[model samples]
Target: MSGMVTSAHAPRRDETERADGSPVTIGALVPLSRPGWAEAGRHLLAGLELAVGEVNDAGGIGGRPLELVVRDTAADPQRAAAAVDELAGLGVAALAGEYHSVVARAAAARADALGLPFLCSSAVIDALTERPTHRVARIAPAQSHGWRTYADFLLGAGHRRIAVAAQPSVYWASGTRILRDHLAARGASIAELDMTEQPATAVCDALAEQGATALLLLVGHPEPAVSIVRSVRQDPRLADVVIGAPAGQPEFAEWAGALGASGAGIPFLRYLPERLGPLGARVGTALRERLGQPPSFVAFEGYDTVAVLAAVLRDHGTDRARVAASWPHVAVEGTRGKIRFSRTPGTGVWQWAWPPVQVVDRDPAEPARFRILHTG
Candidate 1:
């Protein structure tokens, strides 16, 4: 039986076979299908469910089984907001998991308005809530913290002429601005290429005209981004130009499977320590097996999400207000490091402050393997 449950109105026993008939539900928001990055959602869910199974095995939250009331956000802000409403109606103690920043923002806003305590698993937008709220705590690093690190990596790598192939979205726009400000302040230039305004081939032409040494992908996956990469890779004019994705789009296996050698050597941001601790190592092994491949950092984020929530639920009952209030009190040892929350300036929600950040890529010589190029 799956550790996570989908039924909105009933509870089913998972592998735990807990004596208590009642189940504690965490409403999960993930992008499970097209338009959404399904690969990321799968990794996130694997970690959440893996931790859930372990929580159950350890006798659960005071003997009641823990389950995830799953909902697919499908990368839509409106859809994610609706899911937040539906999950609240389902009586979940708290909400968890979401990959896309924009989608998570919508869900976070709605969850806030409804007075639901949400533990965001992933999503790095700085302004998650319009006003400071104790109701939401995040497991992911804020966008500024991670993106600035990525900019430093580019600067250290001798990349001065940077260009971004961008789509129209709040998340992408924020990233472009962050890169532009950080790089420009350090004597570098930043240019924007609108993928929506031009075809992939045309984008290549624009990039070549800009004479950029690095191109940041501030766009979505497998569509214009993939097409742009292929075009740039095949273009002789842009052969020396480096490609980067600060959003970590290339961290998934599907990226390698789809692009093969062409996908290699494009650095991207990821949240993981340079080395995993004992707990992280153990969880990594389990997640690797569960995923049938090496687990991405996102998987660890998912696990930490549940671990924190499980701790909160175990110590403080299932009351919604209590769970939300417990964020500041949390000091659980997570797969990455010790997890805690505080009000980060600018992000209105309670944030983890920072997570280990790495700029990594698939080796051109070994497409299946990853190499860390920079750390933040």
Candidate 2:
């Protein structure tokens, strides 16, 4: 009887618990407005919310469920910094969100100073990961890679004499410069058109006068693209010239028609939200179902950003140190492509960027298709 009591009295097992004996809560800062960011924010929120739900369902972190606290940055760096500061105050294990490069820079510094592992979800500017600051990990590829692909497409097609139209933002300026430099290296003549001062008509006319046969548009806004196309079509000499864009935003289709069908026949690169794998699709569907729409490339970053952070959280168990140390492996298959940060110091910004170059050519009986001109 004593032997039987000893066998039955074996110490009961104890469940694992966190240092504070609490569940992990993550924080996210995203721009819900500022054109092209709202839909993306919703998609990312859905992706994150769904993932968190699943994580909790599987038995929350350290036997405690997960929670997320969210904030909006509005695409302004100052506002983003404030948002980051606010999220930081929540004592979250990790922080995520903020896609604009400038905003990322500020938020990254804040996260680093606070020793928070910052997962930059969708900002594609090369400035985020290029710093020695090393406080941030990105799940988005650099825009330079995309620009390189654009240059290669132009060069391989034997298209010389290129005209570029760009907005004044650093994102556009930097990307344009990268593409321009690459094109020049490959023996392609370039004409830079500053959209700040000159209208699209003036810029197109100038390019036409300069004997430009192909126009490579770098402007993020679709307005300039449509305007340029209208001008080119009006000038019979420039009408048949090859026109290419990095990615035509879907939200601009009506604007494309408003500007005229000339650009409707041209080709542009498009951000494909559906190609980002299961995690991306789930988030995208959630956003559409909940918000009545899907997100753009920027917002897609939000879903990817949250996914990467959640993976880190699952592995590290609420340790900021472990999360930062393991960031190079936080692979996020976003709408663009599989993304993660490079541990190598002083590398260019963006951990992964998979943007496809596409042409928006009009069909006689069908709608415009964003055909893949080349995959970067």
Candidate 3:
């Protein structure tokens, strides 16, 4: 259980409660500890906690206080699956929150087996399940959808020859395929530089030789990814090459902290509209307070996850089947935009169809500021 875990019932002074007095519990799976992207997890947890707090304050599910039964996934698939099984056993109405796609897939599979409702918050893998299951739905944009948009951004920027510093993972592989297929259709080609085999300097050597105009960081953060960015930025031979992270690595403060000016001008994917609507503006302000830093897109995804689930739980009640059934019926105003789930083709689960996608980079002039380069 997370430190943020609320008791099953802790109604406010003015709030009402059910006769049973049991809270409506949500299972929250976040990568909070080592080996996981803990910074992203903190932002994600902040959003989830903030939304859960607001839901409780605004009168929880039918007077019963809403609660989160939090679990730390630690970025391990097996750990995530185990957590899902445990959460299902704990009688949570649904599961939510995870930033890593592979871990989310593992949790999704377990949730499907247990017939537990799961509203995945931030993982963007296209195939979240081995097959379609009503029990699992997603709030994030599908990898195919977001990555194709990223490919178009690269092409429109006139990068004919692109190289990716890729690690071994299904998520990275899927992104590579999406970019390759989309870019190839427009007469551009991609080269893969395996991070497992090459050092950062070696990648620069290959980029220099290939004369690639872009190098996408399709690897993990701060280690190989940060090192690669440093090496590429230092190598004058590849000075003109654009560094990109279609996976949205640089959206958090840690990326800028690690690479500073070198991290600037490196474009990454972000899911946000050109401007926030009224609800979004309010939530963003609240989230900034909750997080003590500007919230990332993942934080919005967390808030939206709760917003959608709370609507379902309030309208349809806490029956597991009803919550699962409520995915198609959801139409809640979220922090980003109107969020609803439907069966998107090839997604194998309920999807939001699309969240706004943008190609953004930390401004070269001010690394703390982000500049949107393209939108889709």
Candidate 4:
């Protein structure tokens, strides 16, 4: 239950050491065993590894090589909190890497309690960064920001009557509420269906009966979204309905493949594209070579997470307090776009106010090839 791995002896640091004969260790907390998100964690680890290799190859931070101490959370909140304490016990200068929003919340609290600088890579819940502590910051935009992007896309497409299918989790519910409120302000009507209580076919039938022209999936996970898409496609009356999900983009291929030809033309919002900028292209190529596939936005976020940490450690050394204090003034151009953290009224403290995002759909013949529909 502790999820601790005990070695016979202390791990060797020679291979990871720099010219200064020391290693600046960073702790990476990711879910490697969650049923639906294990592959996502692996992809994110690939990105972190890629950035670590590049940083060490370039002489590291102030001649001290950066090392990553990875811990798997199993996508569980309690385990994630324990991982934070475990990493701090191992003497890591900072912490990063988390996929699950609920787990990220636990990790953030633990990191703050321990006075460690925690840079959240991919968790999008608004409350994670809203804590009273200055030890936490996030790279991903909050769910409200992402939902607004989707709302704009749906409204701009002339889809006034939209239907939403959402899971019962707090994360999904909050995101769905944002989407609903935003769309409602623009004179759009929306019907709701609870994914946990109803079957996908029944939900699709209800939406079709409501004269819905578009379906927005607020389910936080991919499997349910995929199932709903497949079920909706079975009815000829809903064939023209535009299906979109902001959270399903990371695991697009897995669920989209289940839908096969039916998944094409379905749009989802992604934070980073394959060829966003120079850094994006460079990381994308490295990921394609390492993972044997294109990099997801989560991967890009992972890479940039390390990049930002390295920059801070280089200038501020490994002092946790200094690193956390320096985040407010830290601003740099990253793979996706400009990377900066700011405190906004509704969003949590030290959250990335805006990150570049795009709506893309899979090419029917080639699922790997995604065509961009809109950008914000």
Candidate 5:
């Protein structure tokens, strides 16, 4: 019930769900809840399950269909490793989805050791591709990339002095570095602030002292990022400085509110393929019917991850090595856009899923206010 009827094709049943309910299936593992992320984890799982249903309804991969084996990683490296091993023991063709960079790395290593393809939908740290053991494909733009894009936007908007803030994670570090480099290359000056462990007040004070025209925030966590923005908003000199984000957060609007900031003159970058939405929405509907709601970003990623593997399987067959090798060319419509890999691993850039930038020049809630800055 949770699948797509491609406009070009009719809805069909997957071979996996025969009257007897047996078929070639795969497993999807996601970060289960740690002490703090129970709600987010559940949402991600729901999205993945929704994707599985849609794929099955569309007659499943090569007509064989798939069964999803679900596992919870608890967002811990040790636990994630154990869960992947468990899935491997079950002989799943491929695996997808992890939020933590370290946990994703461990999963990728295991997939490679076991000769399985791993598609990372959210992990954007540049180092994930450095693993020699696992074959991996990433759907999100690398951390450095989103930052560079934001820098370009700010420079174009006549902002020369910028302030940068980021969390301590691998993704945030790389993103902040890239923004610095881009600004320097353009002969623009930027004051950098690493919020790795600093209090929000200190960060805001640092940005205020810089007297920058804008803030380029790459803080990994939305809540703290919001806090930083709010603190800055209280400082008259800092409030007018435009804020930019490359990492997509669902609470971006709420964070803006907490900071008394508006998306006006703010820009956010996304790396998902363009046509991914219609398909993703269909999957969400089907998932809601059975699982009560679509999964969170994590679960949708898992579904996309499996879909990519299934596409490769259809094109290449059951050979795991071939599927890994063919990743650079294996393209599929995802929730964000058409997803594919770069021939050069770890480019920190994606060839597909680039959307035109939009300027938040007014209240973010205003309709048609998102004037296109660029188009695919």
Candidate 6:
């Protein structure tokens, strides 16, 4: 567990000259073995690899190649903590790349205990960075940011009455709460339904009966979200209801497309659409060449995390403390837009103040032709 799991692309590091001449190693804790998230983890790793390759191609940080030490968390909190410990034991300078909020929480604690710099890539739970830590930062926008934006989009679309079918996970629950609060403040009527207990058909019927104009599917996992979408689409009475989800954007398009005509026009929030900026276009091109698909939001986060970390390493050396201290002042151009960190009251730690996001609808006829309805 104290040894590095080297990839073929990673440069070899001399053990004797590790202090000054070895490759700078960063630990990546991702859910590589998780059932539903395996493919997502691969995409994240691909992004990390692309960034590392780019950095190395550009002469790396101070002439030392950047290398990744990856571990599979399986989306399990205990496994994530253990992975952090393992990476720390292997002497990684910093830690990054986690998709699940629960795993990020445990990994953050372990990273703090080890005094290692941790830059969360995509975990969006508000409490992940709520407390000040000497070495924790996040590149992803907070849940409130996404939820508030979603609420604004709903209100702007003239959706006065909205129904929310949400899973009970912290990711979904927190998002639901934020949406509810924001919509309530804007005088929009809200109906909340638990997706775990209630049948999707019953929920769809209830929303239709209540004259709901939109259905916000807050299910965190992709499979369940697809199931709900299928169920909702089965009812002809609910055909006019605008369906939306905060998680699983472009990836869910394929699952939605599996429903044939039923999934044609469902909308979802995407954190970093490929059409955002020049950097996004570059990332998209690289991803398509490498993975044969456009980059996912998680992939964008992975690339940005490594890109920012490389910049920090270039300026601050590989010292974890220095890198952590410099994070608050670090700003780099990300795939979606400019990446910057700021201390927020909600998450009383340095985190990406605002990351670009967009609302995109699925196009069953052409999954690649997903339409962007709103940008933020």
lDDT of each: 0.89, 0.62, 0.88, 0.78, 0.59, 0.77
Arranged by TM-score with the best first, the candidates are 1, 3, 4, 6, 2, 5
| TM-score (all chains, Cα) for each model | 0.96, 0.78, 0.96, 0.91, 0.76, 0.90
Task: Estimate, for each residue in 167-266, the C-alpha lDDT of model 1 and write its tens digit.
Answer: 9999999988888898899999998888786888987788778888999888888888888889999999998999898888889988888888999999
lDDT of 4: 0.78
Query: Compared with the true structure, what per-residue lDDT tens digits does model 6 show for residues 208-232?
Result: 7899999887765555666777887
- Candidate 3 CA-lDDT value: 0.88
- Where in model 3 is the C-alpha error above 4 Å? 1-4, 7-18
Model 2, range 44-152, lDDT digits (tens) per residue?
Answer: 5555665566566666665666666677776777877776666566566777766566677778877777787787765666666434554577665566665676678
Which sections of candidate 1 miss by over 4 Å?
A: 11-20
Model 1, residue 366: C-alpha shift (Å): 0.6
Model 4 ranges off by over 4 Å: 1-20, 220-222, 273-275
- Global fold similarity of model 1 (TM-score): 0.96
TM-score, prediction 4: 0.91
Model 5 regions more than 4 Å off: 1-23, 32-47, 131-134, 220-222, 250-266, 272-303, 333-338, 345-362, 365-376
TM-score of 6: 0.90
Q: Evaluate candidate 4 by giving its C-alpha RMSD to the native, one decimal.
A: 4.1
Give lDDT: candidate 1, residue 179. Answer: 85
